[model samples]
Target chain A: MTTTGSLANGEADGTAGSAAPDKRGHRVTISDLARQLQISKASVSYALNGRAGVSDETRQRVLDLAEELGFHPNSAAVALSASRTRTIGIVIARDPTLISTEAFYMRTLVGIEQYLNEVDSSLLLRLTGENGEDLDVLRRWSRQGRVDGFVLFDEHQNDPRIPLLKELGVPCVVVSSNAPDDGVGRLISQPEETVTLLLDHLAELGHRDIAHVSGPFHFIHEQLRVQLLREHAAARGITVRHIEGNYRYDDGADHTRRLLTGPDRPTAVVLGNDLMAVAALRVTAELGIDVPGEVSILAWDDSPLCELAGPGITAVDQQTMERGRAAADLLLRLAGGQQQLHLEAPPGLLRIRTSSGPVI
Target chain B: MTTTGSLANGEADGTAGSAAPDKRGHRVTISDLARQLQISKASVSYALNGRAGVSDETRQRVLDLAEELGFHPNSAAVALSASRTRTIGIVIARDPTLISTEAFYMRTLVGIEQYLNEVDSSLLLRLTGENGEDLDVLRRWSRQGRVDGFVLFDEHQNDPRIPLLKELGVPCVVVSSNAPDDGVGRLISQPEETVTLLLDHLAELGHRDIAHVSGPFHFIHEQLRVQLLREHAAARGITVRHIEGNYRYDDGADHTRRLLTGPDRPTAVVLGNDLMAVAALRVTAELGIDVPGEVSILAWDDSPLCELAGPGITAVDQQTMERGRAAADLLLRLAGGQQQLHLEAPPGLLRIRTSSGPVI
Candidate 1:
């Protein structure tokens, strides 16, 4: 309550309190920290901001020196500089209702928040209706100097936001499997390796034919996944059939219904996400088809739902949270003036559960 | 490229660009809009901020007039006033991993974002390890004038943050079932009514004995829920047994296993959340018990998992997103200097799915 007095008096902890200039009659700055540590200013900034490039020991030394020097960032002065707000922006261009149900974005947000919190930075979250609205929001925040940088999500082919972000000259990192090689930093997943992992698991189970229920083809990841699946399955001497899904439960149920009831149903079915896989399982149960006995099922993304389902669905764990944290780290480094930051997200792991088994 | 020039000069759209002073020589302000519209300044502010307690017609009129007058809020001027940062803070004192797995927080966030986005405001999200860290964050944000207000979550009995918030003098709204009536705005659910609804549904199915798998008892809502459940069940000639859970999948499975194997197993078990409910369904399957035939199951909170489960769990829809939106609206109003705002969240609806049936 009314902590202004304590904050202004520089309480003993040396945690972000206002203080008078040091013995040299000058406020300690990042440059001073760099000079004292004999490292570049960028390194000192990275260490202080808890960025990825700095080693733990270097970060500890930087922290110790800053504390001894009574160095604390003056946010008001920073704001006046029009350089850094110590805040990052993330705009999700999707229906709020849809976003509420999906666990992917939420997990990503947790990762981003965890990193920013550790660095004593803040996140500015915005949800928009369309790509155009997203640009508008970004422009407004940039013009207002409300954020130091942004973390981009849901990259599309020739994403319009890419050009806009470049034009705005704002630092950003795009988290997607299909991010363009434009100057911006990108955190991408290995689509070919992911596809190979899924295919190898199914092929070893003696499944010669498989059907894939993919997410909407407009998404770069979905397109890459379908293409890679076909390429990988062919090399494994297995036949692959493709069906487009919108990553919804009904899409999975409807496609599975058509596949199971039609001529020559594939022995194994792979879906784009956990929801669809669960939906496919429900469809199997409704039709009295034994899962993994009649048809093996696999989900693209692993979540609690996969394990909770009866005869737990086999899934590829994408490490969504880690990807989020890495993306945030890249964005922070980019904001710190580092260039060409590209990070390959950790590979997806095939979680073998009861849903995938030897073909009967 | 650089938007500084355009942002410094008023454009045709009259949207947030800097503009010259009007004919009166002084810059157009909210007072002018209020005088023109013949409404209180607070009403005009509410309309502009898209907060509750303002009619749609009035909001439209305020927007139309503001556009005509080229009245765009200058964020720089606002920030300098130390009154409105146009940013709301939400500190979720929970494990990041746990936050990612639970759909509840995500849905609430979506709701909060929707409201804040409509008002051209931003959400500052922070995830802390514990209550003490949460307090530190609030104090820091408050001291720095980084946030205009906060939205409190997960209230506990004899909550410590209440006094601190009051002393900080920062406006906030607590979204909880057991928020204290200490002058702060509260968006609370009807716990008694919720308990009665759940009991009535189970009793109607001829279930005389039931077990309640509840969230952590330390939560004020959980305490109120269990107490209300027993009081309501006694009048309905039902016996209620309580099992403490941490709102995890394992809690539901472990409790259900214990109950099913022990003597005088309840005819029905009500879980605290969807994850727990799904876990219980798995337990019944492992034990070779027929759902709704040997024992009935129900869940407290409804989510996609409830419907995806094999039998489709019977659940109480808490309208979490609506609650979140309401809390945001209340907080915005409080930040605008309104006081004593209290709202009752919509009552939970009992969604009777395939999992519940008459006692066998």
Candidate 2:
């Protein structure tokens, strides 16, 4: 651990007064306490931080002096020597414009922030540029000891960050089902159950043919959902077709239009997210199609937009906030030097609304 | 300015080798470089940081040694003595659940993050609990030198944070017109012009009576908008009534129902936000009232939600992302010790859609 030599040596030699302010008249620092107590700064730090190596009498003296002097540990100085910043880093790589419209990320951030607040830690948020600067950021932060741990999101298949984080030996928790269990913490959700619930709802509505407008298949969860949807549909004797979407409103609308206008229109359509479902609803209105009568529509994620849409969209309640809280809990445990944790979030629930019904 | 005397003095006396690792075999630190160069760590820091005290020759030598040794400055160490963290703080003292649904804040965050990324800075985000911990956070962050500056949002009438920030002497930029300009930076939006434009559009549609469902009056912007709306309505020879709304869908719907079901129903309704406008649309539909045919509905802010709504509600485009970028720019300037800045964002544009039409 590197520290400023001149300040500590000069002060230790010259000062014995209790709570003597630095030359600049700044707040009392650990060095000030160390100088007054005529002991090494390391011992003072160890005592204040409740670390081993300091005698009980010395620790008590340090605490008593700290209280009397009104000493607030400098966060930066503590971070440098103690190697803990009390800050967690989250780096998001996505189009800045799209991030604003994503209700999922927003809710997840709230959950993460709520837990961090309770723990008295700060969140260091970074949005990576287009050139995949996320990896670079992780390396720099790790080398600089800028953050104690990281919470990773939007996990891709065989995510490159996993290997990099492992090499750095940084405590990390990934909110993904696909991440390899290589000692890093994992927060997994039951996509299989989610897909089955949606399919069951559609089958019960007597829909034999369905089109799934899914998020980019590059995402692990999307791939899992698609695979599960086909397996479940086959069991129910229902035919299903998959269309790729980027989880945006325009693509959802465009895909819906193409499907409804093509040679074979599915009796029911399931969209990847609430925004896409709202877009599909608009397209159906534009095409003069009667929802739930001529066709049925469902959304994979539930949000206020789905509930507020003209013909309220039937959706799967993913319990996004709860998932966020669970991820945070697992991350904090991992960061606190606990064993690598694996938490499975509860499966989604089907919310039936006006947009889905018996196929006429 | 406190440093570890033993590590530096011991290393400076013993080390003359080129790029010698510390005893722990950890990454190279500024102390390592200083020891190799046989100089004080402060000189090395000043040279590497390109500060004024270092000579040209020394600065070049420091730069060359840093490059050859692959030395990345420790952010925490630099923060301690140099007093610059390259991190900006933002504290939001609102309910976590409401934060997730608000698109305005989401867009603003994107804008702020975009600018910070370009400037190679991180955002330190904090959400205060119900006890108004925001002021405490600001004070602690300032005292700890955790952030170089702060970007404040959701300005309230006579906000207590203003005085606290000033007393702390921390660089700050407030994103509000109502903030008292006492040397802190300000990013003001033209609420008066925005109100005039919306009022003109409604007047052109022959709507003589208008009901304004505004955000909580405690917020300065909402107060300004309500005041402006009334002033502009009177000039346009229109009668206006104000209803308090919490900027949530539920309150917006309830307020709309009360206004529409009342005996003296206004021909036009102006909502505080896009979500509220969507709720008002739903309420009008539930009451069997035709939008634009009986009562015109307009939103104060335009988002994708507004465009996706049935009949596409008219709204005022507030340039939310741009406002966020501007606030970030101003905050960065203030943190850099530039002159205090006060920038006026362009007036919101009136976006006319099918929801506003001639009153029958």
Candidate 3:
């Protein structure tokens, strides 16, 4: 019953045999291998270290035994079966430009690095487009012994990569997941109840017609938000509309233009992210629509970009940095062989700004 | 003599009787190893592949020969000694938060990935503070056979890491380099003389007191820009000032406030980047100083944030993304064992918008 917490702390004591897995447990050791081989521990070390002092005859036997017994001399110098490369992988399955300024990865990466640096691990970052290309890359990497684990981001519900990761026997911690049972630990913002807070706030502002301009529809949270908005609109007996966008500036501008200019336009519009929200502002101004006067805009992710705009956008503060660090903490636990990880993140808070107001 | 380009293209012909070192050179191959050991190519392949059919005696001998001859089994599978992990490393030695909103890394990374993906290579990203922690991590990674090469960003004059990189024999492509024959390629904006263009533009605008707010001062381009501005200002018989500031929002806002509100405030200010320039605009607005009316502001790195600001930030477009791709192409060539690489980037284009105007 050695806990992951104890194991992480015991990292410093590995050299002095402080990492014994209790006296009775059958964890193999260097001395045990030497005793079984009838060779000196020094000779075993030389063979394992790829040193030339060991005879060719001895080195082959050592490698075979080590391989059979599942042992590798990792940085921590623990005699374990796990071939720990001490590298973490994160794949971006989108045009990186679309989400580069989100501050999600920045905060999350810092948190991941803070823990990994303490444990002395490196990050392997790959940015590629979706359509299962990332899975193929991960498969190749696993076979080639590239990374020890992954910190998955932007994973959607029923993501196909879950099955592939399980199949490959790769360990990972996914952030903001919405799966039935993917066997992946998730670090996410709190309950789905908060979606109503936004709708209710807008509804209270005397809005009859509402619209939601969204990020990529493939993401579960984005889909969930869209569905919830529709449900709330139906429940409140208010007219609502949904427009799909790619989370790019063009996507937001084009969608905002079409929605705001259309005859049946909503008084208030909610954008998927701050970047799009900013873009929406430009579009609104271009269309001669006044903020909080004619067209009210609400943005997701309370990034600085939202506040810095002409009319500070109303947004949901997701606590990006805290969540990022939390992701790393859970990932470390999962990597340490914890079966279940369900970290509850700081819930989203509705920051009412000048962007949203009573319907004109 | 066979070139690296031909070898890269000949990746499909690895197993055949192809990949022979042509004409007047000695490039060892699997055939050479087989001939030296008086064994068949099948035995060599089996031994090198770590298959069960090859006896332990034969495998050990093959490994010894392979190591001695500097041969590695890379992904593309030509029988030369480059221990191709097919992983490229890039170290971000700055505060990622300050510059995350800029699309520079996003664009550059895409370019880097486009080429590396073509050759089936991955990117290992390490973000660290400016205290040279990245080099230490890279040294460990190099010893661990982690990455085959690097794509270094923002390299400066007399950088301590240059000697270390050379010492470690790691292949790299440095952007904005100012070293004397560091044996690395550079992907810089074309027209190396754009600094004078900015100064000349400003000087002609009747601005006697000019100032520069920049990114990290340790970076070569920033230093070079500061120097060139001073030289140009001296030539034009105008006064110029240099104040160091991290390219962060707070830094921009705080520095601009102090400079503009000071006893001898400059009529015009040039910032290190768009984020700062945007911050400067807010500060000016808050301090009741009209931009381009009371104090003209010019920013570097013509990012979207610049154009989207209250007053579109006048900037010099360095074509960051294209330069990043060029860096990757040059790095690939250098990794192919080319002796020298000097790729000039497209020069910066001075784009004047609403931010900067004549001194009133």
Better of 1 and 2 by DockQ: 1
Local accuracy of candidate 3 as per-residue lDDT tens digits, A296-321: 99987777677778888999877665
TM-score of each: 0.79, 0.78, 0.75
- Residue B62, candidate 1: Cα error in Å is 9.0
Q: Measured by TM-score, how close is model 1 to the native structure? A: 0.79
lDDT at A7 for candidate 3? 26
Task: Report the TM-score of chain B alone for all candidates.
Answer: 0.78, 0.77, 0.73
Candidate 3 lDDT by residue in tens digits, B1-360: 112222322233342212334343444455456667876544665576555657899989987886676555442233212436667778777655543555566666765664454344577877654545677676766676677767788776676666777788877778865544546555543333777788788888888888888887877888878777777688887888899988888999999999988889999988988778889999999999998999999988787777778788899877665566556655655665654456555567888889889988
The superposed Cα distance between candidate 2 and the true structure at residue B126, in angstroms, equals 1.3
lDDT of 2 by residue, B1-360 (tens): 111121222134332112234345554655556667875555676676566667898888877887777664432233323437778899998877878887888888887787566445689998864446688689878988899888888788778888898899998888867546588777776787778878888888898899999988888888888887888899889998988898888999999999999989999999999989999999988899998899999998888778878889899988777777667656665665555356565467889999999989
- The digit string of per-residue lDDT tens for model 1 on A1-360 reads 001121222233342223345786565655567678886554666676555667999999988988888775443222213337778999988877778877888988987776565555678998865425677778878877888888988777787877887898888888766646678877776777777878888888999999999887878888888888877888999998988887788889999999998999999999988888998998899898999999999999898888778889999888777777667656765676645457666567889999999997
- Ranking of all candidate structures by their TM-score, best first: 1, 2, 3
Candidates' RMSD to native: 12.3, 15.7, 13.0
Best by DockQ: 1
**What are the per-residue Cα lDDT tens digits for candidate 2 across A23-96?**
45554656566678886555676787676767999999988888777664433233323447778889998777
Off by over 4 Å in 1: A1-83, B1-83
